[model samples]
Target: MARRLFVENGFHATGIAAIAKESGVAVQQLYRDFPAKEDIIAAIVEADCERIADQNTLNTAVANKDRAGIIGWLTTTPCHKDESGDRMFLEIAAEGARNDRIRSIFQGIRDQADENISRAFAGLMDSDMVEDEHRTLAQAFMIVSFGSIFLRTLNQEPVTPASEKLITCLIESATP
Candidate 1:
């Protein structure tokens, strides 16, 4: 309920009353559970991050030795397929800018994702190499991956082909 409202109306534009009404919970109960809208947003973001980590399937891919497949999945699979999902993503990102708590959550999500990407790529290549190198590549991979969605959401040309090519190249470069 709150998720729908947040996706439709945005973070700042959404109100506690609306969330309560949409969720079919009493305002007091909602407040007791989540003292503030930011708390709700925090809970949602944390859950979403965990979901992304799971959906990436990076660990499984690495375990299976599917090196090339990881790049394709990471750049595309985690991205939202529809515009509304993209909008909610962008909105949450913007909200994170002014809200310190939200920003920290975003940072944690990014850091955790970077670590996972680095590990996935490292395992895929069967290499025990520089953490710094893998970390840098992971950062770039994330930028290109998320940047594609932002570009598409803004009605710009999709960046998937290029991001895919870049990620593939990075993977190959790191390959032994």
Candidate 2:
């Protein structure tokens, strides 16, 4: 409920009372569950990262060292009609720039994501792909993927083949 509210209404506009009303929980319970709005966004980001890490397709691609598959999934998944998750992610990103607490959460998410992407890169490439190479590629992928996703969502554009090709090209360029 907090996630939905935060995504739907701007975080600043969504209050405890609104969340409680939307969730059918008492305000006190909501507060007990999450001490503050930052807590909610942090939890949401953490859960999202965990869910993506555990996604069967993601696990299979990583386990199989399928770089192309991961890139395809990352670039295409956010094109869904309901872009609430992507929007919330963008929201958190915007908030992160202005708030230290949100920025910390973003850093945690980035670290976790980097580790996962590094593993994937390691699996995809041969022994020549060292830890530093993996980190570089992983970080590049995140920068491009997240920036592109946020921009595309903000522009309300449909996912075009050109955009898909751009991601593929970017990933290929950074691949070890």
Candidate 3:
């Protein structure tokens, strides 16, 4: 509910009272749950992080040292097909630009994602440790993922094909 409101009306434009009203919860109760609007936004982002940050598949592939499995994972963009979700993310990103708290939240997500991607790169190369090359490729992959989300949300064409191509190139180059 707050997610929808944030996407439609934006972070600053959407007030606690509005969210409370929209969610059919009393403002006091909402306050008890989330002291501030930032808290609500944090909750939303945390849920998204949990949903999208599942590294089990990658961990399994890495544990088994499956190069093909790692490549398959790398090529698959996790960007959801839901435009609303993407819009919500864009909104949060915009807020994060000016808000320190939001920026910290997003930074944490980025750090975790980078770590996971770097580990995956190490796995892809059958290396026990992540090298500088792996870290650099992880950073690039993160950019591609963010770019794909932005392009997809904007209804731009050729995002997937281009993103896939870039990812494949990255994977191929990273392969030993």
Clashing pairs in 2: none
Best by lDDT: 3
Clashes of 2: 0
Q: What is candidate 2's TM-score against the reference? A: 0.80
lDDT by residue (1-176, candidate 1, tens digit) is 78778888888889999999988999999999999998898788777767657644776677677776666556555444556666767877888889898788778778887878888767756764437777887888788767876888887556566766876676677676
**Can you give the lDDT of residue 52 in candidate 1?**
57
Number of backbone-clashing residue pairs for each candidate, in the order shown: 0, 0, 0
Please list the residue runs of candidate 1 whose C-alpha ends up more than 4 Å from where it truly belongs after superposition.
63-75, 78-82, 128-130
Model 2 gets an lDDT of 0.73
**Can you rank all candidates by lDDT, best first?**
3, 1, 2
For candidate 2, the per-residue lDDT at 118 reads 67
TM-score of each: 0.84, 0.80, 0.93
C-alpha lDDT of all candidate models, in order: 0.75, 0.73, 0.85
After superposition, the stretches of candidate 2 with alpha carbons farther than 4 Å from their true spots are 55-82, 128-130, 170-176
List, residue by residue over 1-176, the lDDT tens digit for candidate 2.
88989988977899989988988999999899999989888888888876655556766776666767766555544333347878888888888899999989988988877876666656566433448877877777677667666776888876556456765665576555
Instruction: State which candidate, 1 or 2, has the greater lDDT.
Output: 1
